[model samples]
Target chain A: MEALFAIAIGTLTSCAVYLLLRARTYPVLLGLTLLSYAVNLFLFASGRLVMASAPLTDQGLERFPDPIPQALVLTAIVIGFGMTALMVVLALRAIHATGGDHVDGGER
Target chain B: MNHLPIVPILLPLIAGSVLLLSTKWSPNARHAFSLAAVVGQLAAASMLFVTVREGPVLVYALGGWAPPFGIVLVVDRLAAALLVLAGIVACASLLYAVARDTETSAQRFLALFQFQLLGIQGAFLTGDLFNLFVFFEVLLIASYALLLHGLTADRVKAALHVVVLNLIGSALFLLGVALIYGVAGTLNFADLARAIPALTSADAPLARTGALLLLVVFALKSALLPLGFWLPRAYGAAAAAVAALFAVLTKVGVYAVLRVYPLAFGPQAGELANVAEAWLLPLALATLAFGALGVLAARSLRIAAGWVVVYSVGSLLVAVALFTEGGYAAAIYYLVHSTLASAALFLVVDLVAGDRTSAGDRLDTADAMPHGALLGSFFFITAAAVAGLPPLSGFVGKVLILDASSGHPAAALIWSSLLGAALVVIVALSRAGSAVFWRTLSPSGGARAPRPSLAALAAPAAILGCIAALVAWGGSATAFAQAVGRDLAKPAVYVDAVLGGGHAQPDDRRRLR
Candidate 1:
């Protein structure tokens, strides 16, 4: 199971890096979103995977997943969401103003 | 700890929110309010600095929760120094901005500026790694909007580069935090120091990778050598007032490096001992050389100022790579000097750039100024200070750095590079100065030159005055830096203060299920 998750993360990151180098803004934005997804997953896995148990404070169980990484991932996800939204708006504005979709706004 | 540590973060947060809602405020009223708030911040931070400058670490655990549970803000002399420096720059730039801005929408800009301060101050004070991430986001988000305040095409383009690069860096910061927590089971710096010593090799790769990733994140933020491509363009595009405030922003990255590398992964950190020093030194030296070349190649004064900022970052990191008390003292002194001098440079360039409309910031063109000689002297003094000429704060700071570098194995290389970078700067800036100011000097030469107003001159003059204070009080400031250095060298005080001196670790953390 861990191997599967690792492989997925690796694939996502490789694809993200490849797309990040593209000339257009949309592709780069998509790449950032995908990269963020990978990062979020990595953050989630940092808690060490658990099955069939939640680490509720009321229920003190020996077999419970660490809760901190969940909080961390949730925070990261919210931040990532905001980041994506900002990037999207910035991209659209760049395209509208410069009449170009290239990342460098096509020769200023 | 008193309420002082939290005050630095809270003051700005409150002011920012108030200013954000004050849309009814006239531009003048808004400027007054913003100035009042920054004055409050400076006062609070000054108090904090005085309290911690030569005293014990002040730790404020939010909600009264101890380490590993609640967010912790640990303010030592180092944090106090950065806080005070940031405050000074913020205050000076506020004056700079308020005097020139005529639009009522200045309220929003002021609000954003306050929030930026909040983020920067929080980043400096926070003892928890995850909190640092949150603060980084706050600063970056605020900066993105601030960079686009004027909404020009060039500014927007530059903002895009800065935003995208910083967003990626944020993701990496998250990755690093996650990896660190995965290995250490805690995000608190003190806890990490404790945990790192006790860790057996659980792949060992995880911890090392995490450390390096954190370093990379900081490197990107500091605009370290290869990763610094975004700096010149983004910063050069900013208005001079905004650029002046940004002078301290790069130093925040330097502060983080100084804070993290030594305490969390210092010599005593078993698994991650000396991780960055070996790699950082050579890279920093290379950055200096590269930045010097960039300075020479720059087409515009604004562009050259940006390169000078980069050059100072390189110089600060060179001291950081030394990883000694003397090195850190030198670094801090240089950090303070460079911040004031470079900020003054940006302001000076702005003053100069406005005179040369046809020249349009190019170094080759010389347009006459209304008071070309006075402005010329200002430019010369500011550039000379930046280039480390004698009788300036820059020289004093460089002397300390040179004094600290003598015993290092790469002493000769360091010395030569230090002198060489300064020489290049002197030559380039002098040439640009001569072309822009002296060669073009005339009693009545250019029609487009605006009269040099007192408001226009006030901010840079204030900045130069501060640099002069640094020089006049150079001995005292050096002593303070030495004290800061001693404090940094003994991380035990920090770790203990955070964890409640001599207190054992909190036992709430359990192993992975």
Candidate 2:
């Protein structure tokens, strides 16, 4: 499961990097979204992949996943959502104001 | 004492929400509320710094929960100093905004400014990695709005570029956080410190990959080398006050790198220090060279302001690449001086613009209040500060960094090249000085001369001049730098405050679980 997750994250990261390299604004936003998912999962997997176990423990259980990473990842997901929304709105506004969505041709 | 650490962040955050609700009210009321919040924040930051100076570092856990399971706010000497600096900058910029005749509505401007202040203070104070990300987003969102406040064609173009590039950076930052979490199973700075060493000892590949991801994310935000292309454009196009506030933003990124890299992933961690020293040194040199060249090539005062941003990024990376106590100290000192100087330079540009407009009207008057002479003095003094002239704060910081690089041959080379480039910068700035302040229109009689409004804009420049003078005097400022250095070199003091012990032993971890 960890191996699969790692591979999936690597794929997403590469895709995100490629899209981010594009000159246009929309693809870059999409790229950031994909990257955030990969990051969220990567953070979740850092606790060493406990199978079918939540971070919160039941009675007499010897171990569970680490609660700390779960809590951190939850915070990150919310923050990531906020950042993505802000970027989308800003990009749309930029297009309306500047009449161009390309990052390269803007005034220096 | 525990609760005091969180008040600086909480006050502006609550004020921001209230301001959003009160948008329907008169601009005066909104401005008054925002000003009150900023002043309150400044007082809170000052109180927090004094309290931390008197005691051990202050730690405040959210919801009264312990660390490793809850978010924390840590206030060490370094964080405290930075918090105070952010407060001062915010206050000064707020003052400047109130004085400017720009088209931005006061209510909207103050609202965004206060939110940005909240975000900046939060980033400095938060002890959890995820919390850092949250505050970073807050800061960025506020910055985007503030940058677009004036909504010019040039500003819109610049803001678009800034948004797109920063989105890429944010994505990478998230990826890095996720990767580190997957490997270490904790995101609290203190927990990660304990968990990373054990993880790296067990599996080298995981630790190496995670460290590299984080380095990239931080480099982008801090505007290191190739990733810094977006900064000059975005900062150059924004209003003077807005640009002044942003002068401290990238430093937050640098602060994160310093805080996390040395404490959590140090030299012992799987080639981490080596990777930083190796690639970052070359990047630092390249950044310095590029910034110097950019400054020389710039045609307008606004464009030169852009190059100053590049110069600051270069100097920051120099400190980071040195990776010594002295190096970090110099970096911290440079961070403070550069932020102040860059903002001052931007403010000076606004003054120059005002002078230029008045000069354009005064075509025929030969002795019409030598606006050019006043500007000439301002530009020369500012250029001297930026180029690290003796007796200036910039020089003190640069000398410290150079001394820190004494033993490292590569670092010394990089430092020397930077000195040479600074000379070139001095020359370029002098040429700009002549063109901007000395060069005049043809002597053909055309129109009546208009009086210059030097009094209106002199306040910001005078404030910067006094700060530069204080830094140059050096008794108290030098002592402060030494104190800050001691605190940074020994982050154990910081970790203990947040975690309540030096390290979390295996036994303690078992007990907690």
Candidate 3:
């Protein structure tokens, strides 16, 4: 489970980095969304991973599975949703306003 | 009142909501309300400052809940002092807009400006790392809207980059927060401080990763060295008043970096102590050099103002890099001075270019300035203040920073680079001053530039006047800054106020659950 989670995060992060490094706006946005996903997963996995058990500790566990990371990831998701929406509008606005999608608004 | 710590954040939030809801309010009416709200905030911040200066840290847990469970707002000398500064700059920013912009412009500005203020003050006071991230978003989202206000292609382009970059910053911030919480089992600073020392060996690596991630995020936010490419491009394209207000934005990054470095990883950080000291020092010095050279190479005053902000951030990182009492104190003083001076310079840059019909702020010798003498003096005073001229707060602030760096091995490098930055700024400003004002003097012909109304000039003039007063009272302010430094050096005061003994139960996870 840990290896799978690690591989997923690494793959997401690398893809995001590649997309982010692109010269165009949409790719960068896509890259960022992936990056946020990577970060979100990484944050979620920080609670040390739990199986079908509730986020809370069950009948025999010493402590609750740590609801904090769950709460943290939930907040990040909401914020990321707003952030992605804003970026989409901004990229569209940029494209409309500048006639180019290159990150620097295209010197042309 | 007694809820002093939350007022700075709450007032702005309430005022901003009111502004957002009252779509029917006249632009003039909205402007009046916004200005009134900023003044009220100034009053609240001043009250907080006085209370903090005379007493201990003021901790206000939301909903009467306590730290670690309920989010707490911690107002120490550092936060209060920053609040006071933010209040003043905010006032100047709003006033600058109200004075110069039309009613329509004012209508569009109020809610966003207030929201931005809410975020800034929130960042200053928030004791929870997650809360800090939320406030950063609040302020940043407002800044994004404000940045795109005039909607010029250049600004929109710049805003796109800023939004994307900051969005990434947000991701990293969350990433860091999560790792910290996972390792320490809490998101509160006070709790983190306590828990970090006892972290199991296995958690250490994750904690370190979290710390380094946070450092990178802050460095990106503050526009430190290599990560600073987007600043000049974005800030240079922002409106004058917006740019001026943004002087606080970079400082937020500085404040966070300074806070986290010491509290999370400083001496009490136990095994984590001095984890970042190795890289921050050299990077900061290089940032200073980079910013100084950028200032020298800048083509326009507006762009130069952006570089100056970057330069100021560099110097601030120097203070953090020092990681000593004197260093923190010096950073505090420099922080205040740089915010004021940088904001004032950005404003003055606009004023100098306000009346020029062609070559707006290009520092050219072509067109004559409309109010050359008055604007010229504002420019000179602001330039000198920024470059560390005598009898100005910059001079005193730089001396404090240098004094703080006295014993460090990098002292000489910091000094030379600082002095070098100063010299470069002087050259840039002088070249800009002479070309933009002097060379187009009466020797050629009388000035033909249109004069800006007194209203437009008031805010920058008032800001510069404040700098002058600080310069005159330099000694006392320096002393106060030193006191703030000593207070921050001991995080116990902050922790005790927020999560110390009796409040511990209130913050326990069981109660929270």
Candidate 4:
């Protein structure tokens, strides 16, 4: 299951990178969002990919997933949301001002 | 007083919140509040510096949580010194802003500026990798807002490039952290120090790949060579104060590279350590050559600021390449000097621009020496300092770096480049000065004398004073560099502080899980 999740994230990251390399603004923004999601998941999985339960305390349980990475991912998720919002606003403003959404505005 | 370590970050954080809440207030009130906040931050930073200098490395665990689990703020001598510099620059720029009436949307700008300082301070002080990323994002976001404050077409365009490039860097950084955490199972610097040695001995490839990923992220952030193309464009297009503020941004990247690369990978006590330096040295030399050439090729004052970015990359690379205590000291010393000189130069450029009638014609008019003796002298001094002439802070820092790198072949190349670049910079800046401030205009030698306002004069004076102080205290400054170099060389101080001292056995590692 952990391997599957890692593969899935790796695929999404590649897709995001390709889209981000495009010349259009909207697709680049989408790419960033997708890339951010992949990053968040990847960070989460770094704690060794627990499937049965969270890292919360339980009676007689010797081992559990690390909680630090989870906490870090939570923060990243919040910050990532902020970043995406800022990018969207910036993109919309650029589109409104330039009347186009291309990265270099066809300047070649 | 024990809690003072976090105050450098908290003061600005709280002030920004207050500024946001007081959005409907008069701009005067906002500017005053911003000034007060910066002054307070400066005070807090100074106090923290004193504390760190006098005591053991100050560590303030966030929310009272210890390290390796909860977040921690670590204020060693080096971090404290940087905090002090950031506070000073932010305050000086704020003063200039107040005088120029450039404090548009004063509350928002001040809030973001404070947040930017917070982010810088956080990055310097934090002991956790994830926290570093958080601070990087915070600083970058604040920078994006600050860069677009006036929303000129050039600024917007430049800011778009900066944001896109930086976002890619940040993504790479996050991926590096993820990979490192996957293998090491801890994000704290101290824990990583303990965990990495064993991991490298067992699986060198994972460690090497993670280290390389981090290096790329930092190189991009520091504007090294090819990855640095976006910096001059973005930074050169912003307002003077904004550009001056950004002078510290790339240094943060250099600081991270210095801190992480040496501590984590450079001293791994195995074959891994040998391979790490081999990769780092060439990259450093390339950065140095690229930066020197870039500065020579740049045509405008703004473009020159871009060159300074390159110069910093080169200087830092010299230290990393040499990988000696003296080399690291030289790097830290040069870091301090470069930040001050660059900020001073940018402020001077802004002063010149302020007296012009239009942005395009600003450089043209400034060349006419409209500001008279006072402003001209100020400009000459700053330009000289930035160009690294004798007896200035820049010269002192460069000499220390060269001295530190002496006797090594890499040092020889770096020193020659340093001297050659200095000569070229002096020539370029002198020509620029003559063209912009001393040359008589063609057709009619009678151009209107630029009557710069008192505020314009004060701004550069403030920055120059800071530079002068650094130069005058060159002895202590070198001593400080040596101290920081000692600390950096002995990563044990950091590891001990972060991991509560002692090695983590394999059983203990399992217990941590």
Every candidate's DockQ is 0.74, 0.55, 0.63, 0.64
Please state the error at residue B229 of candidate 1 in Å. Answer: 1.2
Tell me the deviation in Å of residue B80 in model 2.
1.3
Candidate order by TM-score, decreasing, is 1, 3, 4, 2
What shift in Å separates residue B307 of candidate 4 from its native position after superposition? 2.1
Model 2 / residue B197 / CA error / Å: 3.0
Off by over 4 Å in 3: A55-63, B441-449, B503-513
- The DockQ-based order of candidates, best leading, equals 1, 4, 3, 2
* Candidate 1 ranges with C-alpha deviation above 4 Å: A55-60, B101-105, B441-448, B501-508, B511-513
- Tens digits of lDDT, candidate 3, B1-513: 277777888898999999888889877788889989999999999998889886488888788786677878888889999999999999997888887756325555778889999999999999988888989998999999999988889899889878888888888888888888877778888887787877778988889988888888888889997888789878888988899999999999999977777876878887788777988888898888888788888888899999998888988889889999999999998899899999999888887776676668886666676677888888898999888899888888888888989899978888998888888878877888888887763333545565777877889888888888787887788788888788767877777777868655423543333
> Candidate 1 at B417: error in angstroms?
0.7
The residue pairs in collision within model 2 are: A42-B178, A43-B178, A45-B182, A46-B181, A46-B182, A46-B183
Per-residue alpha-carbon lDDT of candidate 1 for residues B329-386, written as tens digits (9 for 90 to 100):
9999999989998898988887787767667578764556566778888998999889
Tens-digit lDDT track of model 4 for B348-465: 7766655443332233433344453565677689878877787788888788778887877766676777788677777767766666666644324444645666765676687788
Predicted complex 2: CAPRI docking category: medium
From the highest lDDT down, the ranking of the candidates is 1, 3, 4, 2
Candidates 1 and 4: which is better by TM-score?
A: 1
Error of 1 at B157 (Å): 1.5
What is the interface root-mean-square deviation of candidate 4? 1.4
lDDT of 2 by residue, B1-513 (tens): 357888888898888888878858887777678778888888988888887764467888888777876778888777887887787777766666766644543666777887998889999999977788888888988998888887777787777777766766776676677666655656788777667667644555666666677777777777778888878878878887888789889888888877787777766444344445666778878888888888888767777777887887787778877767777777877887787778778777766665564442222233233356676677677778888887788888788778878888785586678788888788877877766655565444444334434443554575466557657666766666666666666656666667775445645665544
